[model samples]
Target: MGDTNSDSPTASPEAAFEAPPTATVSLREDQLQNAVSFLSHPKVRSSAVEQKRQFLQRKGLTDAEIEEAFRRVPEAPAAAYVPAPSPHSVVAVPAGTVTPAGYVPVQQQQLVPAQPQPVRWGQAMLGAAFVAAGVYALKVVVWPYVADAVTKWKASQGEMAEAKALQEKESNALAEAIQAQTSELRNTVELLQKLTVSLEASVAESKRAAQDSLSLADLRAELRTLAGTIREQRPAAAPPAPSVDVGRELASIKQLLANGVGT
Candidate 1:
């Protein structure tokens, strides 16, 4: 019995030694810090706790390690809740009941007149001074330049009008001069035509006179040949003279020839 008890105690210790060891996973310090930072991120913090846990689990984190990281994360500040009265809710009150001492009546609250804001005289005066300065600048500086430009433009327009008128006058004078020259030229041409006609007539008269002179010369030559034939055919013996005077007859013939030459 004593050996069995000792063997039983040894067998129990051997069974304990032969049993499978439990596995434990521990995150590194940097990994824990990273998990804390990820959980603390604004987007991750704004998400649902379950969704954040699932996202961390997808990144290889166990639930315990994620819980540890969440513990390290800072909590967000809680917002104060303000309650508003419901529009539909009404409180019942008796008609003649006395009101609280410090309560404002609804009619007086609604009918309270707004206080008027005091006018800033300094600002008004400053704006007025600026307006006066602008007016002064417009009247004293800008107006004169604008008026001068307008006056100059008017003067230039008048000058242009005068120039156009002068140009038109010059054109009219040139046209008149051209017309006068044309009339003079026409008169000169007519005079030249008349002179040409007179010259042609004079030339024709001269040609007729030349033909008459040639006819007179031919008549004189025929008279000379007739006188020579008469001398050659006359008788050599002296004969009794005729009653007619030959010298008188010869003088009459010379007179007729002189009359023909004059004609």
Candidate 2:
């Protein structure tokens, strides 16, 4: 019982005791105020109070939510006017103009615009030659050949189509004739069988008929006589000169065109 005063008020060496942490707190109020101030500035374009109310109404926000928003809002000063430059031209001060004291001079100069250089004499000559070449092509080189080619192509294509058609018709007729000759040969074989039977009957019944049958000498003579007749009367087809399709060639040539300045 010498000094039983444990509850006595004594200054502790440590710092003051802290309360139970209900929420975190910091010295960030100025930053929060600044952000709100920026949002509420007069020049800053933002939805009006009525608009925000309508938006919150459309969102089905409670009156309590709207009140919390109004409380968090901050006020700011109205915007001040700032000058802007014109795009058409710059305002220039004269060289001898005087300014206020402590006004720093910015020694600025505008860059000079560059201009195109003149071409050399040789280049000029080349340009003239190119123009002259274009003129010469139109006046002297192209029209005559084009005209000739057109005439030749039109006529040749017409003839070529006709000739091709004629050739096809002739070939068809020739094939028909060859088929007729084959049929005739078959019929001639049947007739020759009857003739052979008759000739054999005559020879078997009469020796005079066998005696009238041509000898090998007469057969040889008749064969020689027929050969002479074929040699004298046969006609020859003059070998056709190899033909070229000039119409197609002319058409191909005329269709080609040159491009660029001289074309």
Candidate 3:
């Protein structure tokens, strides 16, 4: 437990330093800086301090743990950078050099190479002319064809729409005509059936009447008997009645017979 606690970064600086010699933990400067940043954030500091206070109070480490939680986290500070002398600035001396009476050491200066300027005027003008020609060609040759194709495509679409509408209208009219023809055919069939039924009934009625009627010969014989019986009932010397027109009645009867009344 002591070994584990000693390895924790949250341990006090003194406790971390007092770790066992066998525990050889080393932290780089960048790691220390990152740890300091992580520990110094406001929310992390407050929460960590509160948690450490509660935990330490429960575990009887109130003073040390609470102090460690709020204590400043040490970080690796940025070091000031010092540049080394360049070889050009260094003066070399010979091992056994003899100098003149007024000898002065000369310091060598570094020369910076000047950057060359690009001379692209002719190339730039040529590129500009090429671009202009391409634009002109596009406007003169390509755009007109594209516009004409678009117009033709739009006109074709419109024609297709109109044709579709016209076809739909014709289909509707044809459907209506077919419906009317179907209805007319049905009506004609019904009328023909009714006529057929009526004709059958008339034929049956005519047959029954023919079976019940008496023959023409039988009717004529019965009429002759009736005339004879009337003549026999008359007295031998009866006086003639003035209101009876026997001659006119007989003439009318003869005219009716001539007209084919019973045939």
**Model 3 regions lying over 4 Å from their true place:** 1-91, 98-132, 214-263
- Model 3 scores a C-alpha lDDT of 0.61
* Candidate 2 structure quality by residue, lDDT tens digits, 1-263: 11222122242211112222354344233223332332343443254667655644454444554455456764334689977654444556678988768866554465678888887999999999999999998968888999999999999999999999999999999999999998999899989998999999887767644433434345446546855664565448523331133345334434431111122
TM for every model, in the order presented, reads 0.44, 0.27, 0.38
- Candidate 1, residue 62: the lDDT equals 67
Best by TM-score: 1
Badly placed stretches (over 4 Å) of model 1 are 1-133, 230-263
- How many clashing residue pairs, candidate 2? 0
| CA displacement after TM-score superposition, residue 226 of candidate 2 (Å) | 62
Error of 2 at 174 (Å): 1.6
The CA-based lDDT of model 1 is what?
A: 0.69
- Best-fitting candidate, scored by lDDT: 1
For model 3 the local lDDT of residue 147 reads 97
List RMSD in Å for every model shown: 15.4, 38.1, 15.9
lDDT of 2 at 24: 33
Tens-place lDDT digits, model 3, residues 1-263: 22343445565522322212343335232223333444554444555445634643453333543354345453335578989877577567797998888978787776879999898899999999999999999999999999999999999999999999999999999999999999999999999999999999999998766644534445466558856865776677766762164456556656655543443
